[model samples]
Target: MKKIITLFAVVVGLFAFSSCTTTDDNFQEDFDTYPYAFEIKNVDLGRVADNEYNLRSTFQFEINDNLRDDETVLIYRLTSTINSNTPVWQLIPRTIYFNNGDLVDYFFDFSKVDFFITARANFNLLNRREYIDDQTFRIVLIPSDLAATMDTNNYLEVMNTLKLSENQVKKVKL
Candidate 1:
């Protein structure tokens, strides 16, 4: 009985000790920091045949399937650039008001497989070539956790926070 008890105690001790040792390599951090960005240049808005007041454009770009519910999509319009390197990006759902009291809004929506850019105005956009043609936009995808901590309105800040450089951004053909 004494020998049996000793063997049982040794087995239990061995099991407990083995279970206490955890390998870091076996564990993965829940935080996902990988971010990506893409640009659409000179994309002409097409009039929705059914709705004259709406000008829309669609692009097919695959987003990470796992991040479909866990990510934030931010869209910006390339308003200007200094020295041909530093781009000034304006965040949308932006509203542009003309002197004549016509207002046009730029906004976007996205799914896991594609995204749509839409221009909606109080008046028909067919006559306003400037608002419908040759528009440039940038789409940035980041984790929801990072998006909450960053200043999304400031394009430069967001870029810096994401550790993204101009060369890193790829231009997508539309």
Candidate 2:
């Protein structure tokens, strides 16, 4: 009986000691700075078809070297406004990983036509200015009720914008 009690106490002590040892390798600190810089790199508006449209865009953001060590999370709100003078704006909110390079997309009914694409990126609870991209062409329904044709120029334009912003952010190191 004495031996068993001693062994149980030794096991409990060992368990407590092991639990106190923590590794910080995977720990990411929170961001503590403000005025983070971000840009919408690319905006791709898919062709409208049968009164429906598909849109996707990519945003690239760079944290100042001072804040780079901190793990930053990015939240975005996308809105579609007509004529740039509307007081009521349609809102779409999405959360994205800052370190992960992913493109965000949305599908909407094209019948409710719009003229501008406004994307706002929120970083670490700080609200950044809304970056507005104007749509040069109007979405028209195909007589055949087919999807709108994909234009090479539009796709290339969006790709170029994303590439440029990503390149700029990649240059930062801390």
Candidate 3:
């Protein structure tokens, strides 16, 4: 009975000791200093119709960070660039300018927010039957110090981008 009790105690001690050790390689418990980073997400601009003159799609981009006092202003620019300069394409300019690039005050109590943005891409695909399969564009959102400084020609240095989120528009026709 004495020998059996000693073996049981040794086994229990070994098990307890082994379980106490933990590896933190997979996870890091750290806080972010600049916890105000924002991002654009869930952008669902569906397929465009061939004869559809005005392709209006409503979308909202997600901002990652919670509300910070200093990061109150945001200037957004949404535009598309046409690769080919064909005459029919020229009927519609390659650069489709969306915003005037003015800094608008973002009002939110919390740090995180889903900043709602509206984009009216005047996708005039009916102009030419020979349509370009895929047209590309960019959506730029930058922090601005002054509201007046944000314009078509003006933008701040720090910008958060949609990595694989380059807007791909199709020029379709019936």
Candidate 4:
């Protein structure tokens, strides 16, 4: 009885380990076997105050091919919200090209006079496949009427309090 139980346990362990293994055979049918991924990092926003702000974001992406066959473009938009539950207003739309190397810097300005700001990056690969990689940051711009009451620390505090919602991670491929 002991021998039988030991053999059964061994068999189960082997089966479990085998089941955990993955291979290309289990890959999705539409999976693009690209050997690289676009990585976005070091996203920073600086407050210029007086209804003006400076935006700077940097990213490094791997390029598997140099023939320009694989095109990776970054699409970004600025969003603001008066209330958390309502729709975010899209303030600006910009596109950056990435086809030559592994790094790209995206910079722009926001003078819409809004208190809240969020940026979303939509990466389009090969002009067909799409992935959503977004980052959100807070911008504290002093209202023209209240410039006298503005404190630089207030902007820093707002930035530190900014959080990325789960909706930001949800990818919508086009």
Candidate 4's residue-wise lDDT over 52-132, tens digit each? Answer: 234443221122232132222222333345576642422223334457532223344432221223223233222321212
lDDT of 2 by residue, 1-174 (tens): 999999999999999766644323332222222222233323443434322233443222222333332222222222443565531222233233356443233222212122233232323111221222322222211112111222322422322322222223222111
* Backbone clashes in model 3, listed as residue pairs: 66-111, 66-112, 67-110, 67-111, 67-112, 101-150
How does residue 124 of candidate 3 score in lDDT?
Answer: 44
Count of backbone clashes, every candidate in sequence = 0, 1, 6, 0
Query: What value does the lDDT take at residue 73 in candidate 3?
Result: 36
Error of 2 at 112 (Å): 38
lDDT of 1 by residue, 1-174 (tens): 999999999999999766544223232222232336778888777776422333344444434444558778899987777867677889998998889998888887777766777788888677777777788888887667777887899988877766678888778886
Candidate 4 lDDT trough over 10 residues, lowest sum: 28-37
Choose 1 or 4, whichever is better by lDDT. 1
Clashing pairs in 4: none
Per-prediction TM-score to the true structure, in the order listed: 0.71, 0.20, 0.26, 0.23
Clashes, model 4? 0
Clashes of 3: 6
Candidate 1 segments whose C-alpha is farther than 4 A from its true place: 1-35, 49-66
Lowest lDDT 10-residue stretch of candidate 2: 138-147
Question: In model 2, how large is the Cα lDDT of residue 164?
Answer: 24
Q: In candidate 1, how many clashes are counted?
A: 0
Each model's lDDT? 0.72, 0.30, 0.31, 0.32
